[model samples]
Target: MPSLRHELLAYAVPRVRRSRELDDAERERGRLERWHSGLDRSLPTRLVRHLHQRYEVEVDRTGDFPTHVLTPRTHDVEATVVWMHGGGFVAPIDAFHVRYADRLAQQLRARVVLPDYPLAPEHTWADSHDALVEITARWTASGPTLLGGDSAGGGIAVAVAQSLRDRGHEQATGMLLLAPWVDLTTSTPSTAWFNARDPWLHLGKLKAYAEWWAGSPEDLARPEVSPALADLAGLPPALMFCGTRDLLLPGCRLLAGRAAEAGWPLRYVEEPGLIHVYPLLPAIPEAARAWRTTEGFLGRSFG
Candidate 1:
């Protein structure tokens, strides 16, 4: 059973952010406008203030997008974490993502780099994949590095890891995936059932977002777009979390099964009746427990 707060949030978040009744093109245009206007990528003022006061916040603008590096004021960094923020490949990084990354940096004594990746409708996965792979590779070269993300970002993390392996680049020491949207095809047999039960995700909306991110119908099955369909061998050890109520659970299970078959060391945790990305939720018992599990995993992996 989930905590009361979890249950309440599960019901409320969907209502607050659910897709409006509009055609796919209209939604795409609206999102592109938001991206072009720069409103979509803006960090919350409160979060920015908090980061400056508590941590060393540095921004690197050399890449296609700005990467924000957050380092704890008092802790010596044990590792580097290149964390991707999730927005279904369409929305921009939310405050919750920065907060979650900050929490991880503090708990793990790591430097967290949050990349502001290009969003969809205006940009496809190809626009950012190689750049992200290079960024991740550079970080992994320095020290023990972990790649992590939630939702669509998790899918990107897995794809980047696979690219690193194929290219013989320095691989991340570990991966942390939270409710990853690994299969853009969204063809998992249980996905439709879970979509109906999921309060925050709609299969129809996700399919549209997938098409936008993939850039074509055929590309939807590409490993870069649908990592669950990719070969899972020779990747770094990974910790994955999913909630039974999430539409992405079937894909998570698919990836976990494939990981096992490929001898990939993956720790998968499934929480019943909780919402998507439960580990990233703030002030919830479930999130706290999930963070503890993550901390333990990082400790062992970094050792």
Candidate 2:
């Protein structure tokens, strides 16, 4: 029998897809693109807010955009996790992911910094990638830097790590991805099966949004734009976490296979039954365990 969570998501996923007001696929995607822009401040925040009670929220707006730092009491701070929050490059930051950076910071006993990068339609993904690179370079300087995020951020983290390796920077220690929506191709077989099972991201919505993101195929194929299509060669070790019910399951499996082919160490945690971005729901029992598992992996892989 399917877990309650999976059943619930299965029921809820189609509702979100059918709820789209736009009559045509193209227009509906454009509407979602605009709708995602204003979510930065309002998307739920408890996962991080709860953890914040035990730690301090530090902001470094000293740069172009708002950059927040979460630090817990710990002696070792040599390693850092440069966290990029996920919202399909459509929002500044989602509340679902804000807490994750905090928890990881507290558990790893290392500094964690999150960049408030822009999302889709309003700005190009190239703009977002540049901002990511700028902040990641600074964050990794003090010590080993681990790249991580849920969903889109996870994909971004992988892209940056692959980029650094390609340049021979030797900075990326590893990457932790949670239900990462990597393959923008939208042709994977899972699209038909998990599409209805996965909530939050609709294939129809993403396809429309992705096309709007890039007017050209070449632009979309850029590693930073779509890590699923990016060459996994010479990339840092990666730990990909995806729920069995997530629509992204197949893409992650493909990423893992690429890592193997490229000779990159790959660690995957496919929770038997969960939904998209479950790691951000650390308040839940299953979410907490998922985070602890990642914490142990990060501790061993990072400095």
Q: Model 2, 1-303: lDDT tens per residue?
A: 444654565567548546442258656557756676545543345554455555456777766567777666435566677887876666567555666665566566667788877556656666656667767877766677778887877877887776776665656677788878677676677677877765555676666556555545557766776787777777667777888767678888888777788777888888866777676652466666776788688778864
Q: Return the top candidate by TM-score.
A: 1
Task: Give every collision pair in model 2.
Answer: 48-99, 89-119, 89-120
CA deviation > 4 Å runs, candidate 1: 19-23, 31-42, 45-49
lDDT of 1 by residue, 39-73 (tens): 64555435534677777778878888888887778
In each prediction, how many residue pairs overlap at the backbone (N, C-alpha, C within less than 3 A)? 0, 3
User: All candidates' lDDT scores?
Assistant: 0.87, 0.69
